[model samples]
Target chain A: MSDPADPEAAPLSATHPDQPRDFVAPGADRDFAGERLTVDPAGARALLDARLIAAHAAGDTARLVTLYAEAGDSSEAAGDAAAAAFYRTHAYVFALQSGDSRAEELHRWLLREGREE
Target chain B: MTVTDSDLAAVSAPVEQARGLPNACYTDPAHFAREADAVFFASWAGLAFAADAPEPGDVKPVRFLGQPLLLARDREGVLRVFLNVCRHRGMILVEEAARLPRAIRCPYHSWCYELDGRLRTTPHVGGPGTNRHAAIDRAQLGLVEVRSHVWMGVVWVNLDGKAPEFETYAADLRARWAAFDRPLAFAPDGAFELEVACNWKLAVENYCESYHLPWVHPGLNSYSRLEDHYNIEAPGTHSGQGTRAYRPMLAEDGRRFPVIAGLDAQWEEGAEYVALYPNVLLGVHKDHAFAILLCPQGPERTVERIAIGYFDTAVLGEDWAPMRARNAAMWKEVFEEDIFVVEGMQKGRHAGGFDGGRFSPVMDSPTHCFHAWVAERLRQPA
Candidate 1:
């Protein structure tokens, strides 16, 4: 019977070890160099695509922002400016929508690349 | 044909000489549409409960008066109202009640808006990878906001955005119950809805007077007789009945809800039920209060959105669950009892010979006050 409108009635949040993490910090994917994975470039790209699809389906804007940014970074690393801009645009949109501070960084990068007004 | 000024002349007469509003006011679809602008939209009408978007990040999409609206609680916990559409492409936004947590993204084209209704992102607006357009001004393209205010847990909106401030509009009733003015603790389980087969005004008219109580709600006659009630007629604002014999509901274990602090001795057994002008019915007692928003779905249908609240949050705990349930059930039963009469009266409106009927001058002044208010409002130049 607790009033849902009451701020005091909101349930407290606590992290459990067994719970699956739905959030991925921006640029955290770049730290994967320390982990071992014997996948080719195509397999890695497919994996990133799968992760993006899952994040989009879950409506996980934070994850979408991070994954899209990671995709943009990968495209840049491969010297594909057009593809990089496309992925960065997706990241920037998600970042802005989620109110993530990374939107400022993404916007700056897009502006430097002359892809944004 | 619509209910013209001539049709409402009889309703605008003195209480003793007046007939009720004509049948067309209640039975004609065309007249009902006209009332939407003149009677409801032009006045401060109840839109939804503030509880609908209770906490920060909560958002609810509601269709009231056939217009889609979004009710949201911004990050600072302020309740806001906006037209439920994206600034670009005019797509509906926030199709359901849920936590926004960050921003609102239209599913159609992925356009984003901040919880405060600011246009945050318009992806690919300038072309593929470009978001900014020289002609697309984000500041000028935020979600359209409707004029809104929250009082007594009801989110009141003036659709035309021209009504006086809510405090000024409701000044008389606010001053009348100034003592009962305190933080209202919503009884979570105390919310309910009753879809009556009647025009929305019929429900308001039925709630305006208490003359039918002895016969309509016979159960209350034991402790609260017809004579215990008095008319409250505020000419152009509101009208209702006040009962001096109101008794607080008690649980089987004899527990009673806490009374609002600093109330005068009169509220101990006194309570007032008011139909605040167009669409909201309100009641305040020493222990608790209730609000009912009469949402007009069409000419002959109304959904009575009811919510009850107590003086404080004490009734929200597990210890007070039983008492809260008992109190909610008691009011629900009382409200249900009145449904048939309003619906029957709605059906009676179709009777060709019925000339809006007559009122008992001694007992129906509150109802007459409401009828006159509606007639005068409808007669105004649109």
Candidate 2:
């Protein structure tokens, strides 16, 4: 289903926990149970951003880290490099909070951008 | 770097007592990167043909030596090459070859640039639909331009922007073939590409001499004898061989293409093959001409972009398809014949005993001339 909050973002593919799908995380999460699944990636930003907000509200650090990373990649691919870097910063924080191994990966990226000491 | 000053110095030494450039010259990534600066970027490297963007508003994205380049034609009908990177966030502006309507709009932020490469508008740079910004300098943020020149239907780019003018750099070859200083149209079925499992220099070395004609190209020797070939060695400019007994590559029906006007009596029976250093191999005859653009993929790989053109633009139409096909096939066969030998030479370069190998003092002068030219260029400080 489209994220009602940010209607301007690209449409994103939905994820169903029980449904086996392609490896497109940092995109859509396995926990998502969207009402209408999609293949179009035009307003994916709003949908993923909504997902990230919901994960944060639910205190789901694991989901937040992955969602934040996915948002960064989509933003980068869409040519909004500033937004991509911003999302990456959020991903790095959640990665540390969740004790995810991706924290190390994100840390290296932060180092590259001189974001982390 | 695997290539040292001593190895390159061997190029100018006495041929019988000298060694070819070390195998690392063709195998090491670092050495290749070094040449990318001193040789390829500093010289007039082939990028595209004017035929690729014949009309206004045509855009082609090109990657040369791993640098993104976008070729565009403006409304005024002037062709230009740009860095292909957007100024705001360094996004790739154009990723494909297509004709644009008026402007190049960035896919990410929707920032647009005019056909002439001016920063036209920023859809939402200020805010949502607000285009102005006190900090952003529109004029200075225009697309970075690249130094480019066109000659004989081929586009050449000097990334460093320090090389002499194309006319000055190519004066000797231009003066030699001045009769062919006319316009050329690319034949419709005249373009094709080949992937070779060999370093680019191997192809150049293989092309600079005709010593392998009798052995490797037995079919070519049937009509053109080994004795009929002579060397073209204009040091620092270009080097290759010329065939004295050249015959038109006619169709089976024996129809001949229109000859280029004002050709000297020599061209009536002569054809010259020259490697205009860095990466273009050219062939000139009385009726038609062709150029091979070499794209080096890695230490042991290369992609050849071949295009055949004619003095008569009519040769690009339907009636000339058969003749163009015949010419393409003939050249394709000849180029294919050298794949094994060139690939074999690339493999041999890995052997510890291959100390850049030796040059035959008599039959290898043109090839030596090429090596010497490359060494001289690389010898310059980057």
Candidate 3:
């Protein structure tokens, strides 16, 4: 997947089909830039998005955290601060699940808006 | 087989004239079901010991009164109880006790909850890796917290959320034993449980009065004579017996554990036992106190969770461990000794013609008081 022009867009490491998040079509991982990720031969990117939606619907917090973090970028790129904060807050939940630095970014963002609970 | 109006009428009479509760109150399925809600749920029941979840992020799941409950300590080190069922799919959440680092994650769906019971994450609810949906409101749903209070080293819960404040329900007994009002740190050694083959009510009845002590606990009778004990009755609250000759466990070197400060000279060798109505047996002494949280598993099974606490936590260092062990062993023996009679009384309740038996006006006042309290609570509109 090609990285988005906006510096604020989510990191594209996992966006590539070769990344671990995608196990559907091993070699096609690099084809997932935006919509092509959806319209590919197997629509791996689209399937991944759909799977993420399904996971959220099923109350899968582990999957939801990354999905929400990714959603924050889209919401921010679309100029929806409230929506971005909400998605970031949701991602921050999974961030708290680990001691790693992933949650720090979400924490700082939410903390700036006085939304850190 | 539920409690009929006639059953309620039997325990309503004055102590001198009243009979004990009928067999149906203890044996009937209908009455037990009613009690699951009205008696046990509506009233303040002793649920667990505070020491069970002593630190922040410690989560313990408790199945109380047939309801799944979670005892959790939050990030800020505050402890609270919540319904263990998840709000999303009604799944049972924390099933075991562990030090949960950040949040309680539901195994069925990974719906995460803050230690304080807030529903913090709903994962993919929005759409493909989307955790947002306009209809999904995080504020609208969180884990349901059960009403609870910690007192005297025990955790007490009001399932129906209508019982009076703990201070109000226990004011009388607290005032009577005001001398031992200081903080009580439970000694680790003095913890044990007894599974009694008797109805829960039978255990409570046996504990409320000292009328059977001379016969049931002959060892205790040697030092604490029957006449040295008096009945303690607080209508609608607590009732039991008190003794002036409380025996303290002495080490081989003739050393006794430190006594609680501010205890009156009268407490030099005195102790009191009180049955906090519904289901909790409490004992207070000059140096230590105990709460026996009776878990009523069924009509004929009661598990006594007993914990003994000292006046101060600092007093429980390794040096006092031996004394604590002796104290625990002594109490365990005393409690085990009373088992037969309580189980026997439960067996006797099954007799076809036992008309709720009768109470000895002179010696059974405390038991009668408990009967009255249970009768009064059971009679209320459910």
Best by TM-score: 1
TM-score of 1: 0.90
Q: What tier of docking accuracy does candidate 2 attain?
A: incorrect
Best by lDDT: 1
Report, for every candidate in turn, its global Cα lDDT versus the true structure: 0.83, 0.79, 0.79
Predictions' DockQ, in order: 0.35, 0.02, 0.14
Q: What interface RMSD do all candidates show, one decimal each? A: 2.1, 16.4, 5.7
Q: Model 1 lDDT vs. the true structure?
A: 0.83
lDDT of 2 by residue, B116-201 (tens): 78885554455532445777788898999888888888889999999999889999999998988888888758889999988899
Off by over 4 Å in 2: A1-117
Q: Model 3, range B1-382, lDDT digits (tens) per residue?
A: 5667777888889877798888987777777788888788888889999899998889999998789999999888888999998888999998789887687877775677889988877655654334546776778788998889888888889999998898898889889988877789887788899999888888888998888899878887779999999999899989999999998878999988788876787798789999997899999988889999999888888899999999867668998888888889988998998899888888887897887988999899988888888888888997
Better of 1 and 3 by TM-score: 1
Q: In model 3, which regions exceed 4 Å deviation? A: A1-94, A98-101, A104-117
Off by over 4 Å in 1: A1-43, A98-101, A111-117
Per model, how many backbone clashes are there? Answer: 0, 7, 11
Question: Which 10-residue window in model 3 chain A sums to the lowest lDDT?
Answer: A12-21
Better of 1 and 2 by lDDT: 1
lDDT of 1 at B165: 93
Scored by lDDT, model 3 comes in at 0.79
TM-score on alpha carbons, each prediction: 0.90, 0.76, 0.82
